[model samples]
Target: MFIFQAAAPGTSIIRRDLGAEPLPQTEALYAVALASPATLAAPPMGSLNLSEALIREVEAADVIVIGTPMHNLTIPSVLKAWIDQILRVGRTMKSTPSGKVGMLRDRPVYIGVASGGFFTGERANQPDFLTPYLSLALSSIGLKTQQFLTLQGPPHWIGARHR
Candidate 1:
């Protein structure tokens, strides 16, 4: 499954130029499940429509790829909304005596985050909220493997690469 966040200006190029695919929501989930046959079913999450379906996608996927662009030194609103949909109480995560226990496990998450400025400690930019927040959020659901590829500035970080 792929989470594409291109709400930021100039990032629409990810689709036209980079040839990326976006994840489907709601009833589309039914189509994919029917086409590919899976043991996934929507869980109880109040009146939310996509929450259960999105969780199933994450759980079924062996690897998750997220494409996002930093906005205002953080993740965009669309991505945040998607996160809210996926992260549900007693479903993706649960409260325990130790703390909150993540339900889903044994999956790798790959995040592609593009930014206009460098985010490493030595860079002029401040600490990146995108990576840390995503780490915590996804970790809460036991999907912990993550890789971030950030492209900074118009020239596109020609000098250095994030490792």
Candidate 2:
């Protein structure tokens, strides 16, 4: 929801709160679903123009950090919609005889995930499909370096003293 960009010690920190001004969900979904070689190659208009704007923001970033709350053991629908808007063929990736290759320069993608229940290791009660899926998704777009920061535990256990 909040994107924080770290800068030099004396430099000012840049912040963009995507949550403050959320994009229309219906518009995002339609843009992604209808995106194709022809649609992207055509004159930049309407939703395609919007997609271009989102792509520009992503392309301009040096480090991309995503803070997301886990919903139903995975990313929320709105976040998925945002991902769909940015991950465009020929822009983020391209097809070739070998396969699809990422066009964006490789960068660090830090994911901050907050979950209600245990979602890691042997004590985990819930299945974690978010981490792997996100990793692959980002890698496919050339953001290979990734780091995850997770805070997991039920609300009831937050202030309980250990025996």
lDDT, candidates in the order shown: 0.64, 0.72
Mind giving the per-residue lDDT tens digits that candidate 2 earns over 90-137? 788776788767888988888988888878865589898888888777
CA shift of 115, model 1, Å: 0.6
Query: In model 2, which regions exceed 4 Å deviation?
Result: 1-7, 10-14, 26-36, 96-99, 159-163
Please give each candidate's TM-score. Answer: 0.66, 0.79
- lDDT tens readout by residue for model 1, 48-154: 45667667767766656777788888887667766766776566877678876788885776777777777874664667777888888888878777777667654
Candidate number with greatest TM-score: 2
Scored by lDDT, model 2 comes in at 0.72
Off by over 4 Å in 1: 1-46, 156-163
